[model samples]
Target: MSFGALSDIRIVDLTQMLAGPYGTMMLADHGAEVIKVESPTGDMTRPNGPWHTDDAQKTHGGYFQSVNRNKKSIVLDLKSTDGRDALLALVRDADAITENFRVGVMEKLGLSYETLRQVNPKLVYGTLRGFGDPRTGHSPYAEWPAFDVVAQAMGGIMGITGPGPEHPTKVGPGIGDIVPGMMLAFGVLAAIHHARRTGTGQFVDVSMLDAVLAVCERAVYQHDITGTVPAPLGNGHPFMCPFGQFPAKDGHVTIAAPHQSFFERLCDLIDVPALKDDKRFASPELRGRNREVLEELLAAATSCFTKAELMQRLGGQIPFGPVMQMDEIAEDPHFAARDMIVPVEQPGSARATRIAGVPVKLSETPGGIHSRGPYLGEHTKEILRRAGFTDSHIDRLQAALPA
Candidate 1:
């Protein structure tokens, strides 16, 4: 029940969808008081699926529930003078503010870093964009729309994600969105710490394209120095042999024998002792040279065992695991024990729902979702009260809601 490290922090979150919201959720999980400011229409993800079948009324789409917990929600149309002014008041005492709007939107709203710093010099301001801000490149479509897929494709992840150029693939999850959010969260915290020390807040920027490139660092380095585009090798490590996915009886198992010794150990386990002595397969470098033949031998050995048997016998012996699906992850005992899957009660819904839990664990002050994601404007009155507005003030603001 106690959020650990960030118990004293307060954040005003004006982000939507994935990146910004996910970042704030990290802070919220760790006990920060995060106030989510939404338009009257609410966060776009609120209606995104995996809704509770038993009860529809309380559904806050699985996406929203997954990323938004342990936070309060307040409805404010930023375009409204009353709403913008109210947010500015909240900013005065807030530790941080996070947004993922396209560049220049905040500035147009008169809430840019320069403006916010004038009000509260120690406020950490975090922002995210599809590409970097205009300073990096002249985006012809600077105001063009974008999402996870666009970032992955444009940022070079898709170029090296599959078997070949003709079959480029995107990762299973919206990693493009999620990774930037994580990086931004860390940046926010870093800025927060520095601001607390020096009484000076700084802007924290995370671009989805930049984040994808960072994730694909190997590809960038190889291309920059070697003048070779890293091709998609499927699940194989480009430089490491015997360190990729192989077919099991029913499914695939990923193996990671990064070093020569581990490759020998893997061969011994699979009863392929001759492979250990083969000159073309002896060292990591040589194995890479004979990758196809080695893979064929491994496939033959691995095909005899079911994934479960292979895991039991070889999981810790070498770095190996079965390619798991969502259902498999839900049923995993280790995941359950680690509290990776948590059941949350959504009021007004017929049945309780389960979702992924907070990843970062703190021993002394563990953090978790305190409540389900808020209904649109669920805390409007409360947030207004805290912002030093009287009931009459809130009523006036309500009357001004955009038509």
Candidate 2:
């Protein structure tokens, strides 16, 4: 069997919920050895929805299973001296350790990077916090907890999402968790590369607020250039003409008519030659000034055709796509050809369910889903044995219910 690009790396994942675990899962998918240290009570997401087909075994929640494949799990209570010692043993030789604990939790356990450095100087310590590392301010709520929606609201995503002047909407999906996870994973890989080259490791920190702000990069710049805050435009582009969702006979399709040439192509393709010469629709600036008129005219033309017919007629002529639902995506032929959805078998009799495959495609050392994530502490004995503990010692350690 061939290992993937990150085959030599090992990651000690001490994250729950979404952000930190998502980062480690990214590494695991690329062939890193990720050992998820769960508390005696498993990850909170283990109880989240779309549970396995079996009514009895709620252990394998689809939410938990989705981002956590290609990793092992080991139950440990870090507050216990013995458990911390075991973690130290693992960290002494591991490449990286990732956590999303609120600030000070690791120090409370005496396992912060400063302490861990004494055990392994080459350890790449990565952390994700809601605000930031406690260095900036002793915020009154410094140690307060946070989740995805809170991050989005605090970080400015909610301010720019909705349609009307009074309403603001948070984006769909937990981008608060996902963006930080992607950034942290990139940080980890960069640190690993540096460690491999210079024989050193450094701290990598990401804030949920900071990550969300990064995703709102354009909005910040717009706010800076103009004294006015940008309002939500819904399915419309703020600066580009004919660049938004248009109604179809059955549904809606997005048209990114950003350039003048493309805009001309769109008008021509829709058989609206008179629009090309109309005073209000002649230029992008003019079109923006009379958006309602243009939209009504375009909607009339588009509403006459089905999405399939429109796509067949103007597929390559314009930047166009249907606003697909999740069910629609599952049946898309292009998605199938790309192998975006892959099937994996589980313990249930319902056969196997489909999950997303790896996105980063390499020519030689490509990544893949090697195996499903382990049951809680499924590799406890195996890990202890590899850590040089004897069989009896392993048994004793496992039997001890650490704090």
Candidate 3:
């Protein structure tokens, strides 16, 4: 059953793909009734899959299922008049609506924020874009289409990521899109609260480029204060010594003991107590200045032990953790205890598969993944009935769906 802080809130989600859908997913996870309005052909990610070996139908893929759990789906071809009317009807009572279409797409479809606000003045309209909507601020790149890579490149993340400035690298995950989606979720909730208080709502806009830049906040201040541009330092920090990944015999482990007490303790645990008193590594500043020498020494010491051995010796003594891969993470008991790894039924297959679980824990009204994402148009009839559409009207809406 849907039960959480937002159980009474309903969102008409016109978003698709990663960024927009992820934001709505956060709300839906917290017990918001998110009605995902899709085209008749369904979301583009519906076909994106490394399908389960036992599932034959493949109605929805892992990408779609990951961010779309606990939501209802209804097909609506916004290009058609009937479909537009149906969406309008749904928005009339919705607490909020979200979209990630490029600028002018909604305006062309006659469902722009301006138009929707007239239908429901208090409706919270949240949008995620590559740049930003012109209604808020005009970006020269507003018309330009963008995905994860573009945002990462243009938004300063790629500039300060990877090994060095000459070899900038895209982050492994799609933080370009994902971070903006998270920001959009926060913006939506903030706007919803404002609407409830003042009986008015304003357009909420999150630019992918802006969001990625926000993630690289430290770089901005560093450049401004030091008058020097920041570049990637491989896995090490610019100011901290012995704070990055160090090689173990079998794998790697990250160690952070920049403070004197911790550093002394770490040296003693690693059987290098004399190194802590060495003139070159006596202070944090000295250690940072002589990082290369200290790193070499620490690596030589740590390389004598395997990751498991290092963990056994220093796991809780200092800020230390093994650089674990997915296989290790999957088997880690901490994930099981915290419910960070969850298993859900693989539709059309008897066996269950795992997905990442909710990280935001609410002690009173907890949110959870109780079900998988819906099939295309899985709740079309039920949703339309709740929206006050007659059966005949629902049929007409269905007829208007894209072939």
Candidate 1 is scored at a TM of 0.96
* Candidate 1: residue 92 Cα off by (Å): 0.4
All candidates' lDDT scores? 0.86, 0.83, 0.92
- TM-scores of all models? 0.96, 0.95, 0.98
List the lowest-lDDT window of 10 residues for candidate 1.
50-59
User: Highest lDDT, which number?
Assistant: 3
Which candidate has the highest TM-score of all? 3
lDDT tens digits, residue span 1-403, model 1: 4556898999999999998898898999899988999988788888777766666474477788889988889988888778889999999999999988987998888888889989999998888888756645756767766798988998889989988768999988998898888998999999999999999998887888888889988898899899987878887877788888999899989998969879889988877888888998877889888888889999999999999989887988988889898899999998989998888777667666787897888888888777878778888898889879999999999888976
What local lDDT score does residue 359 receive in model 3, on the 0 to 100 scale? 91
10 residues in a row with least lDDT, candidate 2: 344-353
Candidate 2 global lDDT: 0.83
Clashing pairs in 2: none
The C-alpha stretches of model 2 lying farther than 4 A from their native spots are 135-141
How far off is model 2, as Cα RMSD? Answer: 1.8
| Residue 71, candidate 2: alpha-carbon lDDT | 87
Per-residue lDDT of model 3, residues 285-379, tens digit only: 99999998999999999999999999999999999999999999999999989999888777877767688899999999998888889989999
Candidate order (lDDT)? 3, 1, 2
CA-only RMSD, every prediction: 1.6, 1.8, 0.9
Which candidate, 1 or 2, has the higher lDDT? 1
